[model samples]
Target chain A: MEFILQNLNAQTGSFLAILGAAFGFFLAAMGSSKGVGLAGEAAAGVVSEDPGKFVPCMVLQAMPSTQAIYGFIITIMILGKINANLSLEHGFILLFAALPIGFVGFLSAIYQGRVAAAGINMVAKRPEEMVKGIILASMVEVFAIFALLISILLINNVG
Target chain B: MSKKNETNFLYAVAKIKAIENRLLDKSKIERMLDAYTPEDALKVITEADYGYSVSEVSDAHIYEVLLEEEMQKTIKLLSDISPQKEIFDIFMQKNDYHNVKVLLKAEFLGIEKDENLVETGAIELRKMKMSVKERSFIDFPPILRQAINDSLDTFGRTNDPQSIDLILDQACYKQMLESAKSLNNDFVTGLVKALIDTVNIKMFMRLRALKKNWDFAQRVLLKGGSIDTDVYINNLESPVDSVIELLRYTSYGNVCESGIEDFKNTGSVAALEKLCDNYIMGYVKKAKYLSMGMAPLIAYYVAKETEIKNVRIVMTGKINKLPNEQIKERLRDLYV
Candidate 1:
């Protein structure tokens, strides 16, 4: 444990900043993958019965993917902020700022995926109600959006 | 259940939702009832994507063929996609028991295989027949083998075909309860208990009507049902009204009261049986809104079974030229 802590302290601030960016991107991407995978599975079931429903089913499946994009944007912002002379404190601040989106995106994406998967059933049974299902699923996006906003604001304010 | 296994039903449940749309609704059933002739009824059924070629043949025999085919299709589809095959097998196990009873009865009677033997059992009808014919119990499941051996032994002693049904019926419920318990799903276990309770009540009412002895009633009574054995046995000598009064405290109390009223008014137990079926259907219908898990799949399977049963009832009534009102009275509630 002492050796690990010594190595971490010896590492450049840019390296710590890169780790923060990686966390933001990787965690959010993971959450999106899980959410989209869940929704895709349900979409496949709908498409198997009626291939004509592919368009709407795909739309429902794509809803959970927004969090990954948000994660990527935060990662890019953090990458842009990193510099050769960046201080360890600034790097740590950026790393802590990444937490909101990392954890929230991870959780919200999974739950959103569940909602989107449930929405796929509406498309299967009643095509006309597809819009309603999508809107209902989108309700889960609010938390992910809030997390993304907080992450962006936090990353921008970091010295 | 494992987390992985729980999530595995997303696709299965979605597919079930799609299939649920094709199930016959109450209005469609009413249309079949209102049809002018059996041929017209067949048209409605064909439009619903069932019995398509069989309807062209227009033979009553083909109707059973169509029903069996539909049942086979449902069982196949569900078995293929279900996360837990054994849970779906609970429904098919009864048919297996039915086949066992038929095969054993045929063997004892020195007769040919009955055409009424349904092929929808978890164990294939042909395989069960072969096992019975060869007098080998190795191929059968433990519960099934034990049931066959016990029924065979009883039949061998008394040479009474009736004893075969009694023994097999008891074994069938016992197996169903065991399977349900193993699945550890509350809905399934509750359903099995409800079924046993229905059978017990039906037997009690029938025996009371026939003025059968307590020993005969006790002989046919199955244990492990929700209703206490003593509740049924204690009411053995009581009047039907008192039996129903005692039942009023149970889940099926209201249905029993109405069924008895219908019986008194019409001199038939058809209403009682229909009520029992509808009660089960009503319980299963709660699963319709569930988007995840095994509930929707089980619900759809039960809905399809009820639809097939209603279709059979409708077609048979039309063939027999029963009045529309009479036919309608006999119809079970639609799950749609």
Candidate 2:
């Protein structure tokens, strides 16, 4: 075990760690980018249609950020492993565990953003109850957050 | 999947983007709001080319058109590229549930048969409405009734119309999730699960307001959803505290804090529900930017629905001569 650990230590282990974090961040960030982009576009449209709804529509359009946050959590974990004393196998486990959130977060954020954008448009049309539109769009975020949180918790405690 | 089929997802995303471009923006909404009367608003809506043409516009007419356009756009997007058959099936199942509820409500209230159905599905609404009126879920067309039996069955002994709706929604969500699970498609699963959680929260609020027994609430509550069942159940038993705890601990904590306060007030169901809408919009905005799949589609649908509801609310308020400030307070937070 010591020999294996010594050999593993001799190798460039940070590559895997950094790769995992970057992958997680990039995957999740790309997903969020698509989602937020859709939402922002929708918000812009809604703003153009009804400027009074700026605040409500803007807030609802921000719901897609959870995916990136989850990615950030994974990136943090991978960094911790890279900087600290850990075995290679343990490092791999941490990396693999982070993939679900990164990928799931990415996908969830995209769809959720469209929904938010749509809701923002709704707010622009009916600025009076912008709050209601926000709630409707925010409802889908629970799942992305759940997926991301589980990934974070698993990476933090398990590996 | 063929090479062409492989790009279906991308194609669908692009198509959605195109559709997104057609929607009315905030300034348009403001313009409509500033109009002198509902007639003026109707003229504005018509001029915007919202895909409706009527000889004379009424509030109900505008409502119908807006909803029809939304459904039409959704179908058009879905049709451009057949996604995983299962995902398509799941989305159709939701429409099926909506049709059922509409049919049931119309029937119970003795509404005019042909007046209420929205024409947006593969099946003709007139034919579906007639078939549904006959009280025959089994004899209904295959496409229309595919997963509906399971949904209806979930209502087993419950006589409450709302409970029936709740059961069907839960069942539809369950089946949808099961189908999504089979695909191993994280995007579809996450989007569907988020939808389920939203439905569950709505049902939970309704049950809380009704003060139904724990068992009844459990029966209506969806199992194996993104939400923790135990936590949801606990929240039902003591909505104010449990809900607060869940909100405080979960990812939705920050956004839902105000909703928790609304629940505390109990008299503030409207405010609480508004908070819930805001929370949902916030969450979806986050999800859409992270991934480029059904999240954006689903979020768009939700926002559209909220928009419809808000318009209806505003029109109603206008008709009733409610104060603008009061109307504003009742409006759900819009996600621009």
Candidate 3:
């Protein structure tokens, strides 16, 4: 235990923690960027047809990326536990766990972004009936939220 | 790949094509027209494949079911293509208006609260009821409240029925323009601008029929549309004898020329409004085809909504046992 502690000191472990968080943030942000960008394209197209529909569509598009922010929080948690007796391998394993959340969350969010954007277009055309579009777009975010929750839970448990 | 897996557009188009087969055709409309009572109409509608049980349905139910299915297909086609939530929100913005109106009307008229309004727009029924009960639009989001407030004076000041409607129309147009400008998308901005232009033309004719002050008419005319407002205004007050009046020439001259003629013949603004809706629907269909990607989707949505409006008109007409000719006249021509 002492040997392990000395080897995994403040320097190496702190660097690993920073690296882990950075990677997690990178993965999550990349997903959000793609998702938001794709959604924006669809929203713009719908707005072109009917400008009144921008708000709800934008809210739906932005909801999925909330996971990426959750991923950031997890990374911050990992960094705080830098010298708190975290095995480098355990820390690394936890870091990888964080990656899937960001990767899957980002991909899922992108698809949802598209759905939400299209949903916006639907709203633009049928202002009389927009609940259906909002519901359909929201359904896409369920899986992404689940993915994010699991990653955050895992990170919390690790600390 | 069989026709199903060929291309997303082909697939969507094919699916829509197949679904169109299930829609109520002309013959069905004829049959519906012949139905004497609401029960008979309901039975005829049930036979149509709109993906819902039409039997035991109310006038609003048929509208809701058809709107839902079309919305589903729209979302299906659009889900993987692009993110257009903001655009969708713009369409839903009217729901907020609808909801607000229902609330206000119910409170003012002492009408029973029906859940029907919930199926209409984005606002939750509970919240909508609360806002209505509160007699204040403040509980809504700032944008919603602003939109509601913007139209209040129009709703309040108009004593004439047609003039009362003009307030809502003007408010809708103004909100749409403001919303479009806020988005910063040239395509959307252009489409919205054109829509406003067409709508303004229609409004101009209506005001003229009412013999309104030209300055008041000018106040309602939104600037930055595709057509020049000054030219349109000059033409609005022009005599019928000078048909070749260069100032009066517009892309909308064809459909609206008839309305202008009708305006002279009967002086009814309703006909002009109907012509405007029909012309705008035609322009939207043309624009959708001209622009690809989400433009088609937007077009499809607009087409579907117009179709729903048409359907509603037919259903309402049928329920009231009105003549088919009158219903047909009220229907907006769609790309279907």
Candidate 4:
């Protein structure tokens, strides 16, 4: 454990900053992929029977993808904070900032995908009721949005 | 029951949801019941997308062929989508048992293949026939092979065909319970238990009506139902009213009570049979809200079967010129 800690300490601040940005982007993207994939499967079934429903089905499938974009923005912000004089403490703070969105976005996106997949059923049965289904699925995104907001706030406050 | 298997049903469940809208509602059934003639009834059915031609509808055999074809198509669709085919195989197992009864009876009567044999069983009708003819069950599952042997032995000893049905019915429920348990699904298990209870109740009522002895009732009653065997045995000597009172605390008490009343008024057991089917449909109707899982799939299959049964009842009633009210009384509840 001491050896690992000493090695981590020996690494440059840019390396740690890069690691934080990678975590934020990769974890959120993975979560979004899972969520969208599940919703896409359901949408394909609906569209197979009725091709006209492709638009609404696609909308539901795309709802979980926002987390990935949020993750990408956090990644860009973390990269911007990396400098030649970047200290270990500031790099660690950025890493901690990335953790909130990375973990929360990952979990919430998957659950939201489940909700969106269920919503696809609603759209399949009642096309006019697609708005209601979208609203219900969007309810799961509140936590992911909060995490993104906190991530941005934390990265912005990093000196 | 891995996570992958659970998630694999999303597409199938979505497709089922869309298809569920096409199921016959009460209003359509009422329209069919209101039709004045068989041809008019056929028109109602054909217009509802049952895919039967006028001539096919006119011929009773052809109509049955169409219904069986539709049932096969539905089963095939489910089997194609399901990660675990055994869940649907449980439903097909009933048809296998039905074929067993037919084959055993045919063999005992020294007859050729019976045309009444349904071909939708998990085991093909031809293979089952071959197994019965050769007196070997090499290709059959253990539970089914044992059932065939036991039924044939009982028939051989007593030379009574009725024992075949009794023995096979018990074996069928036992196998269904085993299948449900293997899937580790609570909903399917509960549905099978309800089915066993209904079968037991139907048998009890029939035996009671016949003034049969306790030993005979004991022989016909099935185990693995929610009701205790002793309850049925003790109630054998009692009147139907006492039996109803005893069942009042059970899950199916109300259905049993209404069935008894209908039996009294009509002097026919058909009303009770309809109630039993409706009870099962009512139980599975709860799965409609489930977004993903085997429950909705199982429920959809049951609903489709119920729809076919109702269509058959209506078509037969129309051909026989039975009264509308009588036909209406016999129709089980529609899933929609």
Grade the docking of candidate 3.
Answer: incorrect
Kept native contacts, fraction for each prediction: 0.63, 0.00, 0.00, 0.59
- Candidates' lDDT values, in order? 0.84, 0.64, 0.60, 0.85
Residue B281 displacement (Å), model 2 = 2.6
| Per-residue alpha-carbon lDDT of candidate 2 for residues B1-336, written as tens digits (9 for 90 to 100) | 232332234334433443454455666666666666766765655665544445445554355566567567656555554354344655565666677777776665677554545565445666677777675656554534654554445444554466656656666677678766765656557666766665667667778778888887777787766777666777776646667677576655653567657766764467656766766666656534422344455555556666666766666666666767777777766645
Per-residue lDDT over B213-290 for candidate 3, one digit per residue giving the tens place of the 0 to 100 score: 767777677666877678657766676546424524667676567776777788776676777777666766654322
- Write candidate 4's Cα lDDT for A35-107 as tens digits: 9999998888788777889999999999999999999999999999987667677778788889888998898
Which stretches of candidate 2 lie above 4 Å from their native place? A1-159, B1-6, B54-62, B81-89, B102-114, B121-127, B130-163, B182-184, B286-295, B333-336
Off by over 4 Å in 4: A1-11, B1-4, B51-61, B264-266
Q: Residue A50 error for model 1, in Å?
A: 1.4
Score candidate 1 by lDDT: 0.84
Q: Is the docking of candidate 2 incorrect, acceptable, medium or high quality?
A: incorrect
Q: Give, for candidate 3 chain A, the lowest lDDT window spanning 10 residues.
A: A120-129
DockQ of each: 0.70, 0.03, 0.02, 0.70
Native-referenced TM-scores of chain A, all candidate models: 0.91, 0.84, 0.79, 0.92
Query: Could you give candidate 4's per-residue lDDT for residues B1-336 as a string of tens digits?
Result: 555666788888888887788888888888878888766766666676664344556654356766777788789888887767889878899999999888888878888667778878999877877887788888787888898899888988999999998889889988998988898888899999999899888888788778899888877898898898789888887877888888988989888899988776776788788889999999999988777778889999999999989988998998899999888877888888
Q: Give residue B169's error in model 4 in angstroms.
A: 1.1
Considering lDDT, which of the candidate structures 1 and 3 is the better prediction for this target? 1
Task: State the DockQ, from 0 to 1, for candidate 2.
Answer: 0.03
TM-score of each: 0.93, 0.57, 0.53, 0.94
